[model samples]
Every structure is written in structure tokens, then in C-alpha cells.
Target: MPDPQSLDECVSIQQWLQREHLPLASPRPPAAVHVSLYCVGKSARIPEGVIAAARQAGTAIEACQFELVFDHIITFLLPQDNAIVLAGNGGRELWQLHVQIAIEMHRLGADANLNPNFQPHTTLLYDKDVVPRIALRRPVVLAAREFVLLHNRRGQADYEELGRWPLHARG
Candidate 1:
């Protein structure tokens, strides 16, 4: 997630969407906006080696602070799952981070359901059937010094920050 100010803005957007009768995945705004780099399921299945590798990779990167520009919303109307998300500006650093995380996961044998075509986005809602009508808002820049290893608390959407790795390390 980004700084408090940016997150507040995201909350406002969610509120607007909800009031307009757009199907929302949850009631709380704190759980709405976030940039998920990897979705490794089942913490029990996540090998210790993978976690080690992720930590090593995290330590290797000096560019920890992130500033992402988001402007548009995308809707996936697939049969199994449907979601609306705010797409990022295709930042190279962000993609590199995802690649590093994925590599570790694959090395540790936690590669199941690792999305190769991972696009960095903050999901606003996951609704079925109804195609939400949303316009392109002005670009919002979200900045954060750290990225979180968020684990699902009680299934999808509801999450708790498990581990946090700082970015922009000089070492």
C-alpha cells in the first residue's frame, strides 16, 4: 500500500463506487487498495527456502521506495472470477521486483498458480455479472517506502501484513 494520503484518496474512490451501487467486495476501505506483487497461497506450503530467497532478494534491492501512477480501471469478467482494478504505469522497477519474488517462489517449489502475465494493479472491487461503469480519473501517485508480504486472514480480500521489507536500501 501507499502513504496515508494516497490511501485516503483510494478510500474516497471506493466510497464513490459504493454509493453509485457498484458491487463492492467489502465494506471497509482499508482493505480495498493495494499493490500485490505475488499471491503465494497457503503459508504452510510456502517452503522456508522460498522465504529465505525472498528475503535475500529484498535485501539486494536498494530501490525500495515506490511511486506508482494510476489513472484507469480494468474489469475482468471471467467466468470463474470477476474484478475491477486500477492499473499502474508499467514501472520497470516494480516489474523487476515481481520477477525477483516469483523467482524465489519458483525456486522454493511454491510455484503453483504463479501468474506469468502479472500486471501490477490495486483492485477496487470484485463483482459478478454487472459491468461497472467508471471513467478514467486523473492519475493518482501512490508512494511507499516498504512493500508488505500480506497474508489472507480469512480468505481473499481480508488481509494482515505478515512481513515488511523496506525499499531504497543503500547497501
Candidate 2:
């Protein structure tokens, strides 16, 4: 996880993972790297449709400046799609924020892979085996000041940053 404007953001995450002699992951170059408020899953062929949904979702999520704490390391049970991730510690507000985004997306007809048990996490690496979380680092806290809509084509490295809407709740 990283703060878009923080110089220490990427460096901090790298160092934390490096301490364990672990190799860092090379996820596709993000058009806009962010803590995902919602994942719309596989990219659809109809870009226009996706953009329209995002625009609608933006209206609903105009104010959601939530914080995320990447404190623990974990993995899914699968070996092939194994992943090492930094997860939040039961952040209710964050979940609500994610759910709101999802609800809005669904309202605009986006219901691809909506995992009911959404364990919010940022993947550190993907290995065949369950990379031991024996070396859990201190919490890395990040502000979800903004949420972005990114587009990648068939797992390509390049992504199109469709839009970015900041989170500044009303007083």
C-alpha cells in the first residue's frame, strides 16, 4: 500500500518486504496505483460502458476519505494463484466505503466477480506456495484520499487511468 504523494510510500513497503529477503512482486504498471475501493474484476470490452458506470459511482463516492492499515501478511488457500498480501485489521469504515463503491457499481450494472467475503488486501507477491507470514512487519497505514478507475487490457503491463476522484467528506 502507498500514499500517492508520499516519497516514503513505495520505499517503505519495499524495505518492509526486503527485510525477509523476499523478492518483490512486479504487478502490471498501474495507470494509477491506489488502495482499491472496489475491484470490478476482469476488464470488459466495452470501455464506454465501464466509464459510464464509474462516472455514476463517482457521484455516490464523492466523499470517502478512509484510512487503511496494512498490518498483517496473509494468503488465499490456493497454490497456483497463491498470494502474499498486507491486510487491514478489521476496519469497519473501510469496508463500508468498499461496499458503497460496490453498491454504486452494481447500480450501474457491474456485477462481475463480486466476492461476498471480500478480505481487503494489497498483494505483495504471488508464489506457488503459501509464502510464510512469519515476518509480519509493523503496520503501514495509508489514507484513501482518492479512488481511481484504472483499465488494463488482458493483464497487460500498461493501464489507462480512466478517472480519479478524491475523497473529501462534507463537514
lDDT values of the candidates? Answer: 0.66, 0.61
**lDDT minimum window of 10 residues, candidate 1:** 23-32
Candidate 1: tens digits of C-alpha lDDT, residues 46-81: 566655655555555555566788777677665755
Model 2 spans with C-alpha error above 4 angstroms: 4-11, 15-33, 43-47, 77-81, 112-114, 134-137
Task: Please tell me which predicted candidate would have the highest lDDT against the true structure.
Answer: 1
Clashing pairs in 2: none
In order of appearance, the predictions have TM-scores of: 0.75, 0.74
| Top candidate, metric TM-score | 1
Off by over 4 Å in 1: 21-28, 42-62, 78-81, 107-109, 112-114, 130-135, 155-157, 169-171
Report each candidate's C-alpha RMSD, comma-separated, in the order given. 3.5, 3.4
Residue 97 lDDT in candidate 2: 69
Model 1: how far is 151 from its true place, Å?
A: 0.6
